[model samples]
Target: MATSTPEELPSSAMTDEDYGAYRASAALWAGTSVLITDQQGKVLVQSVDYRDTRLLPGGAIDKGESPAHGAARELLEELGVHTVVDRGLAVDWVSADSSGAPAAMRFPGELIHVFDGGTWNDEQIAAIRLPESEITAVDFVAPARLPDLLSPADARRALAALRARINAAGTVLLENGHPIAPTSLDRAGILRTPRARHHFTFHTAPVPDTLALRQSWGWVFAPDGRILLLLEPDTGAPCLPGGTPEPHDHGDATTTLHREAIEEAAARIARTTYIGYLSDPAASCARARYAAVLTAVGAAPVDAATGRTYIRVLATPEQALQQFDWGPAAADQLAAVHQARHRLGIPRAAQQPVTELASPITW
Candidate 1:
């Protein structure tokens, strides 16, 4: 057998122009079916053989077929999972190429239509026959853990959307049909309202002070895409490094967050990019919350108050979720942290599993 030298190889091997042109002529489309259980909120996923990566049950949409129809068909054919097609979840245009850029010789783009479908129980799911050529295994995954099972980008986008739905579903009513405002709640039947003619008279009397409550403040951020949380010494659960804002504090929430970072974690934050807020108003307290991206510049302090020496490093979101010690926050707090990270443009691969903070009664 004769081995060809680099210089002796045919020039045809050096160029992909022909292949590129052929790809350009092909019209490409894709679809993904998201099987969700109303009872458990778990999605059915399949593990692909190539990378042992998990993916939603789906495949390329055939010619002359709608994406939704394609998704339904693919689910039944690939996994033998029958579902009632409800509506489209997300319609994203992605590249068929790994670079996620437009193909040089193929169609301008590939459309990924995600359709939401009703879910199945463990027994029901166990009965399905998955296409062995593409799917290696199938399992039901909680919405919160979906990020760990799928590609970073796909997981982040999906999780963000799932959370938005959950938050919307958790809306509460206060009086008649009106929703309760974060800072105020009605005290008609449950608690008595205070009444006094003069301010001095009110001060003089031993008036019931059941209405007053303190608010919690904090800045939530993703450090280099990973969540930077502190283990509260008291609760031993993970929490964003923040505290109640003082009366004299200046600037916006971002500034307060910077101060909190220094105080709680002994880390210096160079800048903060705002994401959104969560309302935590209840019998115990009321808070106007804020979240952001916390960028670090240099060394971290050993101690916040003492200003002792400390080691500083950057970690991906996954690392933070696995390593950080959590404290008293609800299990849903982890999901909240992840939602904030998704909004900050952190890729899914960098995100860590947050301990989910429990939903408070106040909403």
Candidate 2:
């Protein structure tokens, strides 16, 4: 086969740049952004004059500027905050596409860096300054509501970065707003559905053996002390694994816990301690919350009753709390779990993102 000569070769389809001044023509751009959150974990977003969708507060890196410094510069210019950001949270490789962008942007494929801007207090938030042009306004939004305000790709990217921050899972690399090897949060579909409200009365007393039992659930600490969290297969909501005593349970919460733990997570729990109970009049049942140390957690086996295996995660109490809406009682229950952990001599879990218990993830 004859090699094609330069005269017969076609020009590369790429972004117009360099004007043949230095290197081969190519379509590539670099930008930087910072993900800032308030003390309450709400993400800060900007509404700019050039686009209908809101975005993280950041902009293109100036020539000779490092991505980290560019992120800091953009933060200062856009928000009037002198905070310097350096920790990288995410790196997204956007594909080249100009069809949907503003005409003047040209839309070269971008290497976008997102840094952790850390949490800002109310006084800091109140001091925000906006320029006369570009960023028109700013808002701090709940993570679950991000999709409603940002572009689809942006929402996914933002949420993934947020989960990385929450997990302290280190910098996540991405392409077109998705992880290559999805994290536990992504695998279990965390935050895909809104957290449902739970109303109940939390009683600290050990549920008396005499009380007729209906439901049972509790925090099960792993060998490393992280609590076991299971996803509700239908709703994708996190739950403590337990249920009403079966005929074989003999009406004991501890016995019920043992059997339910096996069925729900393929876990064998030891050293069960009853911490409290919650009475949900709506459900007309009293659910006992206990704290137990895990003897072992096997690969998730298909639960005999439901036929669907569960998505299991190991979470710190704090991380687990964020995944559910228990109202004020959530705080109370969390306190009890900590107390139980203390009693059992289980050390607090180190800061990390919720991690999957290796198994055939039952979505």
Candidate 3:
């Protein structure tokens, strides 16, 4: 007996394909422009109310506009600046949002085309003519300080671009007729910088094992210059009133540090200054290694329970170091803290530690 073969489905019977086509038609397109310039080898930035910090000036590329043409037009409109495009700097695919979500909305992907524009002085800058509704302020900013002035991620990307330009130039001419080469600046893009990283890993080993440990520590300062030190209930060693970040800690490193300070010391920190990182000399089993610094913005309570006493006393750096025993990582941690403080121009207080007195705080 001959068996009949199964009949094939007709293309007209496919309903799923039609639905997929409909979804593709509903997708939207969006784009943004980022303008960069180097002044004396520093990056120039502008401020926008939409973001908490400053950013490069650029906006959406209108229909029928190439990214290069859009960048030149946007810069002129936003900052009244004009320049000759040197070359394409970079092209990045970024995701952004079109909904203007209360938080940043994500776009499916953005084609960011970066171009090189030779430096322009203030006199050479064209007249800026942006609508007040779109722009607020414009200014020049240093490249090394970009990390602090801009959001960390933006800073990192901008730094990469800025460094690329610096490398291409090979040497920067100072106003004093001095030609400074890239070698003058460290590979990390800092000049006249202290031996920060070396002091941590080589001199003071902050981590015992390499398991990526990030702890939050805050130094509370009074107007009189006295820093608040917490005597651990278990160790009696003098140290800053801060603790390890909790699993639920939300927000960035600074936010986590502030939250930790409030929880451990019962004091709220108002202001902060980023110090830098410290690590172990040898590779540790830990995965994370970073450090930061913060100066107290306002007065902290002497006793969280009573909420009554507030005293302002200053401690010298030496005194503060001597009085506090930082536990296992004390030496490395304190060194990082002091280094940050000095960089920020905070004067160390003068106080003597009585080595005979012993006490420790329990974690």
Taking all chains together, the TM-score of candidate 2 against the true structure is: 0.78
Q: Which candidate leads in lDDT?
A: 2
How many clashes show up per model? Answer: 26, 1, 33
User: For candidate 1, lDDT tens digit of each residue in 204-262?
Assistant: 11112442313233434433454444543322233455555555555345556667666
Give lDDT tens digits, candidate 3, residues 80-164: 6664444654454443442233454534444555556656665655455555755787666545567677765456446544433
If scored against the real structure, what TM-score would every candidate get? 0.38, 0.78, 0.38
Q: Is 2 or 3 the stronger prediction by TM-score?
A: 2
Off by over 4 Å in 3: 1-35, 82-86, 96-106, 126-130, 169-363
Candidate 2 lowest-lDDT run of ten: 14-23
lDDT of 1 at 362: 12
Better of 1 and 3 by lDDT: 3
